[model samples]
Target: MTNEMDNQLAGVGGAEPAGAPSRQEDRPAEIAPTAPEPDTASSERGKSSPEQHAEDAARTNDAYSRSFPSLSEGDVVQGVVVHIDREGVLVDVGTKSEGIIRRSELSRDTSIPAEEIVSVGEKIDVYVMEAENQDGNLILSKKRADFEKAWERVQEAKEHNRTITAMVTDRVKGGLVVDLGIRGFVPASHVGTGSMKNNLERYVGQSIPLKVIEVDKERRKVVLSNKLALEEDKAHRKAETVASLVPGQTRRGVVRRLTNYGAFVDLGGIDGLLHISEMSWTRINHPSEVLKEGQEIEVVILKLDLDAGRVSLSLRENQPDPWASVADRYHVGDLVTGVVSRLVPFGAFVRLEGGIEGIIPSSELSTKKGTKSGYGIAVDSEVEAKVVDVRPEERRLVLSLKQARREEEQRRERKDVEAYQTQSGGDELRYTIGDAFRAQQQSEEGTDQEEE
Candidate 1:
């Protein structure tokens, strides 16, 4: 059986046709010399059979045909670091002799010591710079090998929209430089800091998640974005939140960021816009006036625009509605004080506490043309007025400045008359011959005051 197996193997390596091309040309040429095996001595002594001779011959053939792992100029292969010195690193790559990795080829970061980059007896992958240099030793580069591998990984991540971690290395002209095994750039707008003017130095040495936005093997360029990665993750979370969200539902949120128009609130997994107008019943110029970043608060969901992935939230909605109890606070003929918010051709709008506003018509502004309620008051000035009408349904209030002034004047007159009686022994003034003249003058004063 052993002799038959030997014959079968011999047939495979048998001589090709006389005119055919050399069979070894397309394959690796083995250079190791064949030597006689110990078993061949037994055959030569005439004590062994044909099977023993075939076995000896087969053993010699195996030695001659065996080859080292084939390597080329651009191939990457695993090797063990045999030595680390100031000159370079010696790596054994399954070769006749160890390969020579020069100082520049040790790592992408040239400043790193070879020993720091690699240690003796540690195995690493290296690029074949030249299979055989002038010295017949393999020229290898760890830098190039890492670069090639990084490009492949980046391309795959970009294609599949995968997130990868990169260590921030340095701050560059328009962005931050990161080590993604290869040098990668994260643009200022893509750093996820929300502003391009922010300092990027803080991110140095930090490992952050990134999404590859662009990759070019020819140029050896890679562009990544931490912002896009975060947004994409938020999108999925928002989709889930949107599924469970209902209008008028309450949610606990953190104030993530503030803008002139609104504050962005992070509600568990999603961010919702809390518009300035909806922050309070009273008007505010900016969201920061009421909310600060990192503040936690409860918010009400007002509306969701799924196509745009927009969420409308309200902080004021979660609280009591000032208008809901407007009638209970202000009644017709009740005197109130407020700031003059603005003036229009028809009237001036006054804003009371709790954000209630009432309009004073031009006609009702003054008891007469020269009265204090006349429409010349500057905006934001304090004014006293009487609530003439309250319309909670329309969220409108009608006030009369003239009535408030008239009532004030009448109260002062009554106080003066009561004081005079108190000084006169608590009895009403008597009309006499001398008093008749005073009585008639008083009657005329009363009529004129009433007419005014």
Candidate 2:
């Protein structure tokens, strides 16, 4: 009989293969309730082995003391998994009674597999909701353990300003859903300056950095943002870049955005305006035609307003100036041929040999005409012009089509006389009165026919 009692006691401890048992066998076989001994002194006299009974009672009391405290409604404790069934996992939390954490309480989510979260020997923290119900089993919670762990991680990340990387699991209004074991929010603005598109779907399987902007443990709410981190880095880099910038310096930049007035160029951490006026020497009606997004170009810094944090850039300054050599290439009184390009009320614009325009006033429009319709010039017609005035400083030129022809005729006649004199002496070139009259009459006849 003594051996039988010892075996039952041995089974109570380490009964679960060298581990704590799922539950305590406290009742053992109940002793018959013989009406209390007729008297204490009589009981004592009847006890033949008083010392042995005293030791057994002492051991039983110690075992009960070592068992888990009677769990209250909100006691938290650690436990080891001794058995797992389809319904739930049974854990030995030092309580004589096993804690029955339903599968639903095992995880905040009902769909999570119990085996994946715990194993036969793995130790886990649990919360006690009931030490022993009428059914005599302790009610425990595994989800609370997981939540406590998450909260610790969140607090650590916040203190160190560390980034938490998480995968996008869902899409909700104004933001995305991220799984940090707990659902977290990543606002749309926190994606990237409000320009990130397809972010929710594209980041579904990808992990991205997040800043824990807000956390509410009781409410189990977490908010995260990636844009804040990105903007902070950009601001730091921009300040460094702006400090190093100077006027008149040239750098390579990308056209980031274009507007009607100008284009915004990305000069690393800074943005510069490449105004439409500075795009070219000629007129530019719009910035798009002159600048394209993502185009890499060399630009000169016209002005750097550090206080205002603005940079002015110019692209046309790098091109050669056409007016730089105007004076050296052309001269006053020089006979030049040009095409009539434009006509105005005051004068006609003539294009010279090298894509330059000169003005020929109405008074200078006449050719060798003797009648009222003598000047019959048409638009786009080519004409010989004399450079009467050249104002290279102002990039202006005054031309005379009529004066050029007269100068050419005088030069031809003078050349003929000089040739005759050199060959046969000047005496043979003299003309008499009748000879002059005959030449004048012939000239008149040719003029009349030309006019007709």
Candidate 3:
């Protein structure tokens, strides 16, 4: 049993196989133990390969590029102002880098600082001046964007015959500059309803309505007219006013213009001519004497010519007619005191009241000799006269200065005769001859004194 166990132990401990060489010297030359083959799969699992990393990086970059919008030069985009400085403004246009807008591209005023023109974080439209500049940044312009948008709106306005309101920025030679989102020019002739040859500057800083008359996109020129807009509005209003107007209708109006012949009153947009003759009951040399431009007044419509676009207004018709009741105020054989308004070759005109004049004929100037034909009556002098005839329809009043003086003399003579009779105590014939002789002598003396 022991021998068998020993043999088994030798076999388990790596004893040579049966029939193999028993001697140790018979073993082949021991070769150096070869290192086991490396486990390449386990090593490779420790970290990623360089090519795999490169593929991952490429994918990330492609996704980042797709996140941004495609852009091009001259394209308009909305951007937010990220930063503003003295030199320029930085805007984020959703690209890899923030876009840049130089100070000159912000506004027309180059001297203005960018910070003053734009605020940080404010979103505004921008025009891509350069999609990718040398620095790989978008170059943007605010002014150009505004100009492009403005032109589009302007063109639409012109096509639809629409009116637009714009702020007046500056006055230039022959025109004014207005901001209609873009610079628009209005010629002096089209500035206002009236001439603005020298008054265009008055509209600066004011917002006014205008009509787009002409637009040249290639030239970048736009022509506007405030006058044309006003005229169109006026014409519409005039049509309504003309339709409602009738002869003898009284209306309130504003004085618009004055001329040598008359004043033009704007009666609800319709211009009516108020002649100088119709301005007042009294005579006036000019319309300005009674009416002034821009004054509010009431007038009566005398006549209207719709086809001719003419309106005749009468200011005096709205007032009381002084001559209408002249006959009732004065009658024939009435004595009146008046001022000598004028002296002419034939007679003298005596003014009793406003627009009421009485003429003293040359034949009835005075009672005394050599005083005929109003030789002693001077203009503006006060005198008493008798009304010989009155024609209200003709506006005529004929007076006689001679009759007034003769009546006064007769009254004095009668008073003197009564006093003489009273003193004579009913003796009519006692002093008749003496009285007659005395009167004759007195008359002769008075005549001689008048001659002196």
Candidate 4:
């Protein structure tokens, strides 16, 4: 059994032992030796130590920091919104991590949702509220950033006497509040060119141009004015208008105000005085009879005082003069009917056609004896008169009522004589004359006999 076991072991060592030559003879011919591989860890150790690798990584981090600037509290940096939610917006400000803008920091209107203020992928400027929070996130603000930038611009505008446009956000007790990236106040008195006593509400939600009057940075107070800007522009235009005005020129104007004596007309930017005497050709007791406020009319530039900035306008000058052709319409000895206009101590005034007034002397007022000065002719009564004198140059006309009555009586007497001659023939007329003479002779004889 030992012998068999040894033979089997020999056979296992060499599978072909039974038929194979020797073990050394059975080996493959021309076998070459192989080279062992190098240890990877040992090679790496030779190139660089772990500490060296750590140093390389640190250097790379520093280069990255130089490329992208670091952020700090209160720093104003530009960023892009990555996401928007009810709480706030996630903004990528090139920091170690994305910045968080809380809902309160989005805008002054806290009631509005954050999504309405900022949208994803929208670039905005943010103020660093905190460099890093407890959760290792940056806290940012959008409203504060906007406020800072607006303050800088406002300060510059105030210094340069510049004008800006803003929307009126709210109405307050003393004035209105406007949003110029920040709160700007406009007092009620400065709201417009005229009085705004109860019209402050009209400016709400309106966007208007304003001039920066005052700015207090520490107090965050800014005062703006709309009236001042308007006044300044008006003054400039008025100067130009005044310079261009010339006497005897016609212009269109709007009635701005009225007084007992005259009306003020706005000729573009400047105001001109329109005297009551120049309102019409005839006469007027008050300016309201001819004009009203805001009435547009054509006026003649009667006079201009450039140095004093005064203008005299006339509306009647633009109309035809009534006295220009008075002589052609009236003449002496012409009988006319007129209305008794006014009474005076010496005589009464009679208004003829075309507003022409004629004077009737007290002596000419009546033809009958024992009569009053006015001859019972009250004011506004109608009467007939003869034109005795006419002086159109002096705007005077003399009338005689007595002469008119005397002429009428003479005409009636002539008419009565004509009627008597027509009723009797020629022979009858002769006989009547003879009889009249005989009656006179008989009367004389009787008287003589009585005397004897």
Candidate 5:
């Protein structure tokens, strides 16, 4: 860059503008007065010969060459911002004239204001667009310099496989556009983990990390991938999550999918198996009954096979065991009500609260006369029974339906006996004629109802 600057300076120093006459052609015209009343002093000064005027012009040009440094086009040089305005910016590139950076040259993005890109008195690097324009003004550009530097940076990153972050600017037909100080294109196939075909507008204005996959400076083309970066990050997190997992630890996860036997839970980065057997304390025929896709749940780590990258989780492990407190809740001779769950040849199983099932032997199904075998025990029927025994450690419970019925009958008989004693006033067997007549009338009414 320095050599180029020197070469341009050598060509222009002590020289006049190309095809511009050296005071000889302009002297005659200058001596001719523009106004009728030409000043006498100006005419006397114009009386000098063309040769003398040309010598003075050469001296002046030489002085200017010695005073100002030369600036060449295509050279990126350090500059200090001297002034800024809506129209353009003035930058001092160590030249006689402050270089003008047009609004267009400031940045490719037209929406950004000049004040935001560079402030007064701020030092920046600018690319020389022209040493001097037709208006004798030096032209500079900041965007061109940035573009060159950005390409170099992007190329280096691609070589080293480094990650970079840039803001998504817009959505194109085949991909997304990002401003990496240079235009960076992210193909649709590389937008994320999978080929994203929808909702791409949501990424506009978002800052996303990317990896430079291809770079071509000659054609000014750069290709990037957001999917590769995401996949890499996910794999890294999966490894860490797997290494940190341990049995019995609880974790929060989302149910991703449901299978016949189990559900797949996403534990942040990795997926773990949640078998149906561990979904609840009670039996379940399918995983859908216990979990739904996309539902969030808490589960305990049941096991891990790190070598195979497999994990097993349990939902019921986090729940309290129903049998744990059964002994404290149900005592001997206590009456409990439940629905008949299953009927078998030996007994009927009743589903108690908290998924506890208590069994009643067939002999205790009922004590009512004329009740046939298995007549009183039907699946899904509500029933009341007395708890005869409880073994929490062994998870066994015994219930008898006959005992509950017998107690109810005794309560009714005691009430009747008390009524008779109260009427007799002495526990003596006695009945008045009116009471006998009333009893006969009640028996006749019951017989009449049966005959009808």
Candidate 6:
């Protein structure tokens, strides 16, 4: 058997002679060992294998390729304070090395104590100025982190229509700088609708509600407005107050402010004006004399104009009108004693009982003077005056201090004549005596008119 046949017979694992040809007729022709390959088959195998390799390469490349999270130059990161030293604080950033933060960068507010801003073992947010320092440590900052966080919050507030509390820090060119920790701006015009002449510094350290109007994270700017928020709140409360109020309904209020035309009273969340004319039944020289800021008093809702958002109030409405029942107590020609409450250029004001006051005209002030005058009487002096006219319908009282004495004398003379007439009979009275006396006198003078 040939070597090839011997090898094939051994693969069959049968006990057969090597020289025997088991199936020589069934043997197929095979390529020689030194034969060269064809160009087409070689090129086809090369192309097919390369394509398969390219597909595997693409899958491997895709597995390794992914989008990395972006971190800008001024971006900040958060970490925990693991160490505190004389230089500053060291934070563990979960990186290769600890980040060193300077003491100055801990807080923009210089007055704040270092311990208040952060403490050891407390996790906090920080800014990442350098991902790695020369020593391969992450550079972190607390101030920048605070500002970044505040900016994000401001933007969220703007989008979500949320209200934030911020402290007014400083004053700028045309507005105030609010330390939202992000340095927000509030224009001077938006400080208040009325007036804000007060120092803005006084508002420092005070927390106030604010609404975000603008946010610029790139520029690190935030603009806030309190006026809009205040207006909205005021509008809602004003509507409720107007709905609750009705004409003739009285309530207590505090004097909030004053103007030339009236004084504004604070009735809970809303304000109502008590005009100078509505302050009292009598004339008022000024509203301040009767009304002052922070003074509490009862006021009546006279008129409520909701469309205009205005309310008219009166301080005198709660009191009963003394003139309404005045006529029942006194009548015309009645002599009443009162105090001279005030002396004006035109007349003297006399205050009667029950807070009633009447003006005595300048022409009827005094009887002792040749002309009616108030020279001798001063304000607050007690004086007797007679009521010449009492017009309760008009709520007016006309008095005559001078003519009262004359009328009293005339009344006495009439009473004396009536008594004399009643004591003597009618015919035997002074008529007969006077007739005899007059006849003798005429005879003596031959009538005075003829003699003249």
- What tens digits encode model 4's per-residue C-alpha lDDT throughout 1-452? 99999999887675563665765565665663457799987876677778879977899988986886778788999999999887788999997678998888999889988877888899999999988789888899999999999998888888887778899999998888999998999988888864855588888999988889999989989999988777877788787888778899999999999999999999988999999989987656699988999999999999888678789999999888777787888788888999998888888998877766789998887764445678567888999898898887887788998787666655654575567778775745543656545654564455335433
lDDT of each: 0.84, 0.78, 0.86, 0.84, 0.85, 0.77
Question: Measured by TM-score, how close is model 2 to the native structure?
Answer: 0.43
lDDT of 6 by residue, 308-392 (tens): 8688999888877788888998788889988898888878999888867887888887544344356657887998888988888
Q: Candidate 4: lDDT of 449? A: 50
Which pairs clash in model 5? none
lDDT of 3 by residue, 30-73 (tens): 85346899788686566598986787789999999989998999
What ranking emerges by lDDT with the best candidate at the front? Answer: 3, 5, 1, 4, 2, 6
The sequence of per-residue lDDT tens digits that candidate 5 reaches over residues 157-254 is 99999889999999999889999998899998888765555577889999998999989888889999998888777788787787788899999999
Give per-residue lDDT, candidate 1, residue 420.
67
The candidate that achieves the highest lDDT relative to the unseen native structure: 3
- Per-residue lDDT value at 329 in model 2: 79
Model 4: ten consecutive residues of lowest lDDT? 443-452
User: Model 6 reaches what TM-score against the true structure?
Assistant: 0.57
lDDT of 4 at 47: 71
Off by over 4 Å in 2: 1-157, 162-172, 177-184, 189-191, 194-210, 216-221, 325-452
Candidate 4 at 71: error in angstroms?
13
For candidate 4, report its TM-score.
0.51
- In candidate 5, position 327 carries an lDDT of 85
Query: What C-alpha lDDT does candidate 2 achieve relative to the native structure?
Result: 0.78
lDDT of 3: 0.86
Listed in order, each prediction's TM-score against the native is 0.54, 0.43, 0.59, 0.51, 0.59, 0.57
